[model samples]
Target chain A: MSSPARRGRPGYDQDAVLQIAVEAFNLHGYEATSMGLLAEKLGVSKSAIYHHVASKEALLELALEQALGGLEALLTEPAALEGPADSRLEHVLRGTIGVLVDKLPYVTLLLRLRGNTEMEREALRRRRDFDREVSSLVEAAQSAGSLRSDVDARIAERLLFGTINSIVEWYRPEGPLSAEELADQVIAMVFNGLHAQS
Target chain B: MSSPARRGRPGYDQDAVLQIAVEAFNLHGYEATSMGLLAEKLGVSKSAIYHHVASKEALLELALEQALGGLEALLTEPAALEGPADSRLEHVLRGTIGVLVDKLPYVTLLLRLRGNTEMEREALRRRRDFDREVSSLVEAAQSAGSLRSDVDARIAERLLFGTINSIVEWYRPEGPLSAEELADQVIAMVFNGLHAQS
Candidate 1:
């Protein structure tokens, strides 16, 4: 709507439109936001905006898919996929943390989606699949008597994954530590005790 | 908004109204949903809606207040607040997990807020306070020589809270494990090794 005041750029550019959409969704939330608001923010006509992305839901899907893809790649890395159980688990955990940090905004939005729409539900499904794979590693480690058996594999899986997923809450790359350093710190804390093991 | 339509007693009661609002907020998001939709779904006038709560923000505040109060209560419980350091730490962890299970919906929403609004920022501050208390417990446990010292207290604190906060992602109470049982399992997995302790 505010595009009326603009003089020259009459068309929507896909990448620029997506950047605006990401900010809008991040600031106001996907469901609360409107197409008119998005168009105004991007300084483009509604139809011009539509020309780049079919619908708002499509934009959500695009962002979510990329975030999930980063996660999936980390899970499937040869190091994460195959190694001595401890080594493999560490790789996966560190890689996952790295993904969350690098793709903070996108992953933050993805994590916030609670399956309200078809796209969100699908995102949830893919996420579960990824979790399922990670749980198998937890189980394998448990069966090997490497992990403590007192906790069930499922609960361990949830706690470990939960901790990794929480990074998006405060992890800002520009703030202090690099994503790599943060990942290393996370692995050390989760694997080693706060007090030096005597 | 729709209260006049249901002037008859076929109208919803207070619990019904709260549930409808929760569902709408959960689906469309808290910020996007309006009292008008809530009234429409309840088949009541906005005046009838006012009979229950002052405004949409009030409903949100009420919901979050209950969830955060549960957490604060857990921290103050004699078991969680006292005893040898490790025992107290364990008590807080188990109690917080139980609280999360009991108030899953509200806590989940609270965890996802990004502080865009004054209410959200206050909620976040309350959350940090909880984290600070938990971190103190971890520090005490380390000082008491119960926890290992290989990791820094701050990093350990993040992992501890992150693990607990992650619970909302997949902890379905309807699933096989009861909340207490899940807590037990979490403690074991976190404290024990995936590998046989060397």
Candidate 2:
């Protein structure tokens, strides 16, 4: 059985709280996890959490904001934005998947967050916006004849993200594959076909 | 606002207690959702639940067993097992996706279930078995040169299932797409390329 996650860095220590939040949210789920539980997980009182954030909702908002912001940053990266559309799309895909894997708990919590709270709703909206940016890249790639031309872009977008997002269900950082290894494998599978080479 | 997910049917005599079980299980999550709250949700006493299932774990076991049975049955069908690997794989994919969509609530709960309780672990064991069956089909498809052969069969299996598994995040049954429509779209995206032909 996997041991509980180790805490993150000490100074600028929202990282510890974020890690604990991600774990608690993932284990019990966001709706069921409470700020008090988070504080307990981090070996602190609930009031100490407030010294850093205003409310449980604020913590959630901050966590999702980081997760979404990482993805959005990938959109603006030099390699992701330039080059042939397929290569650029591939670049963005690899970068985003890498970010998701590295920040697995945070992104998992982010992806699983439904609009139960105002913070969640905002996160959901930002997620959709990220999706649209990726979709635009897919459109560009399709126009360039790199991606296949028979299926609808919207459906393709959903499948691509769906495949990428499902990584959370089975991905364990402690497993044989490192985060980078897993991301590379996903990218190779998504872009190049998975059949054995002749 | 979700129409309160009405309990019972016009003529089918749907069990109200089951509806409460499903909602509570979905909302609080099965591990955290309790008998007292379930009783409260159903507007019934806790004894009413015991009258139906032996315990909370029993309720979970029944639900997952039913859902997994539906999925396993599809995998063994002649169409899913025979034909060109792509066609058979597509048949399996479409059937599985359809089942997942038709049984969203049950399957969603099934997918999110961690091996917390004995019943949950059994459900997980069955899920792994189901995954293995599908992976065999993927392996067969690769051997037949129907699927790309560049990626490892195991990882490829993960991708195929991952893509299918992601439906939980976005699909809305009450939305415009019928289950069959969604299934077709999902199948096409995974198997047939998505770029529009010039």
Candidate 3:
């Protein structure tokens, strides 16, 4: 969980306020949503929101940080750091779906942004950086002879991440499938393919 | 090629104009772009754009038709219609990637819309219908014993498409990798899985 902003009131929390803000941005385009509108939706004074977040853009930055930060941190985790290249790659792939499911709203918003602003641009750059790191892992697995070397590592990584990110397009927390089940299916399909191997 | 509007003046094709419009809608959020802006970018009057498309919304529908229509048509193609379920599924998957590459801009816009308007909602519905059709194909392949039945058919379809749809996120027409090469890699990974088969 993110650290709360400077506490301004007895009852309200910054994380809760950010959740509402992220929802409004998700429902309404970030460019179309306003701080005033978020305050209205939160039923708090505009001053109260300002007390938590410095500005509307700040909220966007924090939301993006929340989503991308998780993935970045996953790269250094013990699971990722200590495994064979193939196992580590699997760990990151599963971790990615976990992050997507955990921070669905934030990542959805991040994916939707057009990079028209500095915050969105920074997010795009960081996203590319993350993709590059994952691509290197794919290359490593190929070198280790566990993964097929016929496909380009970069393309393989893109498809793998693409499959993972596409979850945001249709997954609903209220839906019948749990996140764990969905991730398992994804791992099986991506790592093992859909065909029944003899 | 789309039929050009009754030419008010000379020299522009409706297909060409639609391509420009799709690019604009993609670069700028669809809602944020307008007929006047499209005209200004096209170096023609708003009336000229109207000469081709009935309205802003009309162009959106046509562009959508171009993207989704390709996939809808693929369902009935000879390859999709006359093969083992596994082969038919492969044909459809490859064809889906082809359409995505061929109509990248239009599909990108369709994917990014937030369903804030009637047009977007209709597009979303059509998109869901397309997904259902593909899911049925997956089930058929599973029933045929070629594809793994352990994973839920719907989950399998989502990951399959998730990988294909993700091309819109990073594919560039001028990039070093040809669309055919990328599709080939996708097909291999998706059909055979990434792990080296014994």
Candidate 4:
């Protein structure tokens, strides 16, 4: 399938290559997928792929960056940075859900990383930093008496994001549940008890 | 390391073999772990490992059963069956936490299944059935005016258990948070929400 004509196609840019590579990585697992497999899936030669990236790990780095970059950007946005801790936390939660929905495959890949490589370890470190940032926000909300102080901030952070992260397991972009609707339901359940108010 | 003396040891049994195999499966992807690797890990010949399980798929079946059995048992427990729907749901949630904590490795394996084979397909089906059962309870609670009716019952069930299932990603038996403590925090956050009531 390594035709020069196919490799020279106008639409087969680096972004297109990355999208397909990430999908392949998510399907077969990063550790199991080889460049040959990716080349075969892309209907291109290994050289065609290498023309865009240096190695398989580069594809992973780009994918992780795509997922992490979206999340990190949320922490610094006007609403997230300027609001009351509770509101800011809410914004972050909603924003994170948006990121997960928008970059479902990339985020799914990020979540499944096992830290078997230096690149993965670095990604994990960034992820932990992101968690710590959210945990700090939770602590701020608790101190402000917006969020319940009884639950440890770290544990609260874990449960909140854990529930959010689990969406990648079952969510489909084409499914009836829109991203905004999902954010609304999650926000409602999280900020207000599910118990019917008397 | 395939010493006959090691194979003859009283401590080496099917349970022991299954335990190590599950651990290996969790560390390495299940498809990547071969029986030869399992034999090496068990310090026995392939034939000695075979004496306990017929094949690698058999080991996977046994491991999945260990995990699924724990979760399935919770559905039939009196607390899970005999209370108001919300209370019954809480009991199942707490019980699930206990099972996850007790069978962390096995459950981790079960959660990561990709359904590449019939055995995995059956396990996935059972998992869906378990999820459906929980969703029905959520629907019952909503009808009983205990759970908020606005949110979709199925979505609530997913978030509740998704948060629960995520514990395997980070919970450690030796960590400061005990299973009971973890369950309390989860139950508190899930049913009560994180917002501090004035």
DockQ of all candidate complexes = 0.42, 0.40, 0.80, 0.80
Q: What is the TM-score of chain A in candidate 2?
A: 0.87
lDDT of each candidate versus the true structure: 0.77, 0.75, 0.85, 0.90
Expressed as tens digits, the lDDT of each residue in B1-198 for candidate 4 is 346656545457899899899988998779889999988877777888888989999999999998898999999999889979999999888988999999999999988898989989999999889889899999999999999998999999999888999999889999889999999999888888999987
The worst-scoring run of ten residues by lDDT in candidate 3 chain B lies at: B1-10
Candidate 2 segments exceeding 4 Å error: A1-12, A28-55, A143-145, A178-181, A192-198, B1-24, B31-59, B83-86, B178-181, B192-198
Give the alpha carbon lDDT tens digit for every residue of B10-115 in model 1. 5566667776787678767787798888877777678888998898988888878868999999887889866888888888888888888988888877876768
Candidate 3 deviant stretches above 4 angstroms: A1-10, B1-9, B116-120
Whose lDDT is higher: candidate 1's or candidate 2's? Answer: 1
Chain B TM for prediction 1:
0.88
Q: Candidate 2's error at A132, in angstroms? A: 1.7
The 10-residue segment with the lowest total lDDT in model 1 chain A: A188-197
Report the C-alpha displacement of residue A151, candidate 3, in angstroms: 1.1
Q: State in Å the error of residue B22, model 2.
A: 3.0
User: How far off is each candidate at the interface, as Cα RMSD in Å?
Assistant: 2.6, 3.5, 0.8, 0.8
Which regions in candidate 1 have their CA more than 4 angstroms from the true location? A1-17, A31-61, A116-120, A192-196, B1-28, B31-58, B113-121, B193-195
**Number of backbone clashes in candidate 1:** 19
lDDT of 3 by residue, A40-102 (tens): 777667898898999999999999999999989999999898878989999988888888888
Q: What C-alpha lDDT, on a 0 to 100 scale, does residue A127 get in candidate 4?
A: 91
Share of native interface contacts recovered by each model: 0.54, 0.49, 0.84, 0.74
